[model samples]
Structure formats: C-alpha cells, structure tokens
Target: MMNIKVAPPYAEDKVLEIIDAFGHSGKTYWKKRNTIKVFEVGNDKWNVKSFQVPHLINRFAYKYVRKSKARRSFEHAEILLGKGILTPKPIGYVEYSQPIGLTNSFYISQNLSYDFDFGDVIDKEFPDRENILNQFTEFTYQLHENDIHHFDHSKGNTLMNKKSSGQYDFYLIDLNRMKFEEMTYEKRIDNFNRLSLTADMIEIVGKKYASLIGQDEAKVIDDIKKSCEKFKEFARRKGRWKKRIGL
Candidate 1:
C-alpha cells in the first residue's frame, strides 16, 4: 500500500511533481544518518527526507501498531503550528508498505533557510551569543509549559534565524520523536541534556530557564550539567558497544 497526504493550502499538482522526483535524485542535504534531498519546484524549495528503513521488529511494529516515521513527522508539524511553535510547513508524506511490513517512507516539508543552528553556537562564537541562548531557553520553556516534550531536542534539531525585527526566530526539525504529556521539573531539565556540549552553554540556558520558571539558577545549572554528562557518557559507551559488535 502507498499513501500520500498534502497540506490543503499547497497546490496539489506541484506537490505531486516533487513527490515524483523524490525517488530519483536532487540536491542532497543530509545523507549520513538519513537521506534528505532538496528539490526546486517552480519558485519554491522542498525537502524530502527518505527515512532509513527500520529494523525487522520495528518495521512490523510501525506497520501494525504505530504510524510510520514520515506520517508522525507530518502530524507533529501540524501540532506544532497549532501550538504557535515554529516548524517548517509540512508538504506531505509518502509511505510504502509490503506484505512483510513498511518498506520505505519519506517526509516532505518546505525548506527553511535559516542563519544557523544551535550547534554552530556551541562550536563557534556568534554575535549576541548570550541573547540567543536566552531566547532559546525561553523557547524550550514555552514547549515545556505546553507539555510538548521534544525527545530529540538536540543541537542541530533547532534552526535559528535573526529576523529583521531584531529578534531570533526558532524552528524545530526532526519531529518524529516527541511526547505530549505533562512534564515534571526534572524531565524538563533533562530535556536540555542533549542540547549543549559545554558547561558554559548549559549554565547559560539553565540560568535563563530557571529565571523564567522561578527555580534556583544554581540548582537548575547543576541538574542540567549532571544530566548532560550522564547522557554523554551513555552515548560514548553505546558507541563503543556498537563498534565492538561491528554495527
């Protein structure tokens, strides 16, 4: 079975053209973890993410018990927009299934050309670094206030654009891994675990977030730092295990 769902405001014909060209080739944006291709159709740009095929158990689960990643991504984008959170406009999604299970899937969305991501700030010095970090912290606060737990709220998942109005606009990508539930204070702080690389960055975000939430800044910083360190250690251990198993 194959399914395609497009946003109502977009022209269906143009969307069909992009969908047709997705299986072929275009300008590649991401090809390492998953494959993302950019296509120019008419005057607009579209991004089609061809999700890597899942493992056998996951394939069956996605086919039977859960929605495909592409479908989840499309729906999550709509949810974010409804909540006044910025994400790329979802174009559509395509899912292909066979007798065994889901074979392949692709998520389509408008390409957001932004200044840079949080990763850039982590690695290099950006102008107005503290201000940007504060705004990002506020953004995360907003998400937590609304009970939107973005599981993969990592560095590169967020795109920042300095608007002409002299404010930073943020948009989140990679939307499939998310949870919508009331979050505890500890869970909220842990959400930042995957975001920063250094203690300074953690301190900046934790302080801003703590101020907004009226928590002790030092306590928030300490909690976030410990969570980040634990996550990093787990990642390192996982990497070693993967290597040992020849994964």
Candidate 2:
C-alpha cells in the first residue's frame, strides 16, 4: 500500500511519479542510514529525504501506534512555518506499507540555499564571529519563547544565510524530533546541551541568552556548563556500552 500528502501547485500524479523513479533519477546529496537527493521538477529544485526502514518493534509501532518519521518531519515543518520560524517549505511525504508494517518513507521539501551552518561557527575564525553568535542566540531564544524544543539541536542542524544587510537568517532542519509545549527554565537550559560548543563559546551564548530573559549571566553560564558536562558523561557511558557490544 502507498500513501502520499502533497502541497498545492504540484500535481499529485507528478509527485508519485518522482517517488517511483527515485532510485535511478535525481542527484544524491547525502547518503548514510538515510538518503537525501535533489531533484529538478520543471524549473524548481526539491530535496527529498528517504528514511531508512525501521526495526522490528518500531515497524509495528509506526504502523499501528504512531506516525512515521517522514510524516512528523513534514507536519513539523508546517508548524514551524506557522509559528514564524524558518524551515524549508515542505512539499510532501510518502509512505509505503508492507504486510507486517511500514516498509520505508520519504519527506520532501524545497531546497534551501544556505551559506553556512552552526558547525562553521564552532570551527572557523571569521570576522563576524561575535555578530553571528549573537544573532544565533537570539534565534534560539525565539524558539524557546515560542515553546518549541528541538531535541536534536546540534551544530549541523541549523543553516545560516547572510542577508544583504550584513545580518544572518537562521533556518532549522531535522524537524522530526521536536516538542511543542510550554518550556521551563531547566528545560530551556538543557536544550543547549546538544550544541558542541567550547567553554568560551558557551559563555557567549549563555550571556546573550541570559540578557534576553533577564536572568543572571553568571548563574546561567554555570548552569549551561553543568548541563553540557552531564550530556558528555551520558555520551561517554553510551559509547562504552556500544564498544562492549562491538556495535
């Protein structure tokens, strides 16, 4: 069985044809556990992400209990756009079902032409480093204020494009693992844990975030440091277990 949801101005039949021809057509943009490809339809470009098929338990769960990751990514993109957040324009999602459960799925969106991502900010020394960091901190603050918590808020997930006015516009990607609800102080601070920032970089972010929310800069910086430490320890334990199991 097959299911598809698509936005307007793009015919359903055409989108289905693209999905059917996905294997041999399009340019491979990224490939790993999941694959992303760029396809040209008429004059516009689209990015399609094909999710890996789930494991035994999750296949059942996705079929009977919960939505597939592709669906979540598409829907969450709409929600972000509705809330005035920047994400690529979602085109659609397609899912295929097997006798036992879901086989695989794909999420499609407009291709975003970005200059850089947060990873560049962390690793490079640029003339506008401080300015970019301040703008990024403000963007994250807006996300929190809007009660959006991005679980995978890491360095590579946010794309930044420099505007003609010398400021930057930030766009969030990887939309599936997100929570939309009221945010507490602790939850907000913990949200920064996934960012691979150094001590000095975190200090800059913490200070800027504190200024936005009227919190004490020193206390906020200390809490963010503690949160980062806890995340590091958790990662270490997970790594050890994976190594023991030879994963």
Candidate 3:
C-alpha cells in the first residue's frame, strides 16, 4: 500500500507523478545513507529527500507504533513555520508499506537558494564572521524561547543567506528529529554541543545567549564548554568502536 500527502498550491496529481519518477529523473543534490534530489515542475523546484529503509525492528515500529521520518519531517516543518522559524516550505511526504512494515518514504519541500551553511563559516574565512555568529546565537535563542528543540542541531543543518538589507537570514533543515515543549536549562545548553564551533566561537555564542536569557555569561560559557567536551569524547568512543568493527 501507498500513502501520499500534498500541500495546497501544488496539485496532488503532479506531485504524485514527480514522486513516481523520483529515482529515474531529477538531479542528485546529495547522496549518502539518504538521498536528496531536485525536481522541477514548470518554474518551481522541489527538493525531495528519499529516506533510507529502516532496519527490521525500526521497520516494524514505523509501521505499527511510530510515525515515519518523512511524515515527521513534513509535520515538523509546518510547526516551525507556524512559530515564525525559517525553514524550507514543506510540500508533502509519501510512504510505501507492505503487510509487515513500511518499505520506503520521501519528504518534499521547496528548494531554498542560500549562500552558505554554518559549517562554511567555521571552515572558511568569510566576511562578517563575527556578526553572523552573533546573529546565529540570537536565532538559536529565539528557537529555545519558542520551546523548539532541534535534536540534530549540528553544522550544515542551518543554511544562511544574506538579505538585501545588510543582514543575514538563517534557515533550519533536517526536521525529522525535534522536540516541541518547554526546554530545561540543561537541555538548552546541550543543544549547542553538537555544533562544531571553536573555543572563541563558543564564547561568542555563549555570551550572546546568556545575555538574551539573563544568565551569567561565565557560567554559560563554562557549561557549554563542558557539554562540547563530553560530546567530543562520545564521538571519539563511537569512532573507535566503528573502527574496531571494521566499519
């Protein structure tokens, strides 16, 4: 069986046709575990992400107990937009299922034209680096104040574009893993742990965030530093395990 959902202003029939032709046509934008492709219908471009099939246990859970990633991504995008957060416009999601479990799924959205992502800021010598980092801290503060916790709040997930008014606009991507509720102080601080920021960059963000929330800047920076250290250790351990298993 197959399930499909399409948002308004985009005809269901056309979207379905695009989905059906997903693997055969379209330009491959990114490919790894999951694949993202760009498809054009008339003048508009649609970014379609084809989620990797789950393992046996997850397949059953997705079919019977939990929502598929595609569905979650679509729903989360809507919620973010409603809360005045900038994300790509969600188009829809599609899922294919068998008697035992869900087999494949896809999430669709409008392709955003952006200059760079947060990763680029760290890796390259970009103009207005400090200003962009400060603005990003404010953007993240807004997310926390709105009670939105993005689980995968890592580099590359945030796309940045410079506006004509001499300011920057930030857009969030990878909406599948998110939590919407009141955020605790620990959770809020831990959110920055996944970002690959240097010590100086961390200080900039922590100071800005502390000022926004009326917290002690030194304590905030210390806590963020601790969290980043812990995450780094965890990543190192995980990498060692993967290497041990010859993965």
Candidate 4:
C-alpha cells in the first residue's frame, strides 16, 4: 500500500504526479546512503529524498512501531515552521510498504539555493569569517532558546545565506533526527561538538555563545572541547564496529 501526506495549499493529485515522474526524469542531487533528486513544477523547484531501503529488523519497525524517515522528516519540518525556525518548506511525503514491512519512502520539500554551508566556512577562509561565525553562533543560541535540539548538528546540515555584510539567515536540513525539549548548559555546549572540525572553530563559537548566555567563556570552551573529543571517540568506535560487521 502507499500512504501520502501533503501540505494544505498543494493539490495531492499534482504532487503525487510530480513524485511519480520523479522516478523518470528528476535531476539527481546526490546518491549515497540515500538518493536525492530535484524536480521542477512550473517556476518552483522541489527536492525529493528517497531513503535507503531498511534492513529486515528496521523494515518491520518502520512498518509497525516507529514512523518512517520520510514521515518524520515531514513532521519535523512542520514543527520547525510552527516554531518560526528556518527550514525547507515541507511539500509532502510518501511511503510504500508491503504486508510485512516498509520498502521505500520519499520526503519532499522546497529546494533552497544558498550561498554556502557551515562545512564550506570551516574548510575555506571566507570573506568575513569571524563575523559570520559570530552570527552563526547567535543562530544556534536561538535554536537552544527555542528548545530545538538537532542531533546531527554537523557542519553540512546547516545552510547559510548572507542577507547583508553582517547579517545572515540560517536554515537547517536533514530534519528527521531532532528533539524538542528543555536543555541544560552542558547539553547546549555539547551541541557544538558536531558543528566544528577544528578546535579553533569550537572555541570561537563557544566564546560567542557564552557571551550571549552569560556564561564564562573559558569554562564553555573547555566543556565544548571535551565534548568534541568524546563525540569523535564515539564516532570512531562506531565506524570500526560497522567495518567489523561488514556493514
């Protein structure tokens, strides 16, 4: 069976037709763990991300227990929009499943063209690196204030567009892995661990976030550095385990 959910303003029939044609002629964005494609409908562009097929256990879980990734992405985008958080406009999602479990799923959202992502800023020296970093720090602080916890808060998930020299607007992607709840100081600082590749970047963000939150910059820097180390160790171990299991 197939299940679909669409935005109120959009016609489900047209959206489904576009999604159907997506299999034939959409522009391929990237293909790794998942296949992402971009489709044009009139003057607007939409992104449709087709998730990797789940393993046996996951298939059953997604079918019966937990929500499918595509569904979660659609719901999370709606939540972000309601909270005034910046994210892509969720167009819809579709899930295809068999009697025993889910086989495939697709998440649709408006395609956002941006100037750069946080990853680019980290790897390359931008025109106004420090100022942009400071503004980005403010943006993260705003997320925390609103109780938005993004699990994969890594550099690649954040898209940055500069409205002016000192002004920037940030939009988040990969919305399925998120939590909405009150956060402690430690949890907030730890959120920065996945964001920066260099210790210098972490320190810069920590100092700026600390200044905004009325915390000591030294302590914030130390805590974030430690968190970064812990996260790295955990990821390394996970990678090794995956290799050992031939996954």
Residues 8-93 of candidate 2 have per-residue lDDT tens digits of 87778877878888999999999999999999988888899999999988888888889999999999999999999999999999
lDDT of 1 by residue, 61-119 (tens): 88998999999999999999999999999989888888788988989899999999989
TM-score of each: 0.95, 0.97, 0.98, 0.95
Cα lDDT tens digits for candidate 3, 181-222? 898899999999999888988899999989998999999999
Which 10-residue span in candidate 4 carries the lowest summed lDDT? 121-130
Q: How close is candidate 2 to the true structure, as a TM-score?
A: 0.97
lDDT string for model 4 (59-150, tens) is: 99999999999999999999988988899899999999998899999999999999999988885467788788888899889889999999
List the lowest-lDDT window of 10 residues for candidate 3.
Answer: 120-129
Highest-TM-score candidate: 3
**Stretches of candidate 4 exceeding 4 Å from the true structure:** none
Error of 3 at 44 (Å): 0.5
**Model 4 RMSD, rounded to 1 decimal:** 1.4
Order candidates by TM-score, high to low.
Answer: 3, 2, 1, 4
- Candidate 1, which ten residues in sequence have the lowest lDDT sum? 11-20
Off by over 4 Å in 3: none
Candidate achieving the largest lDDT: 3
59, model 2: CA deviation in Å? 0.8
List of clashing residue pairs for candidate 1: none
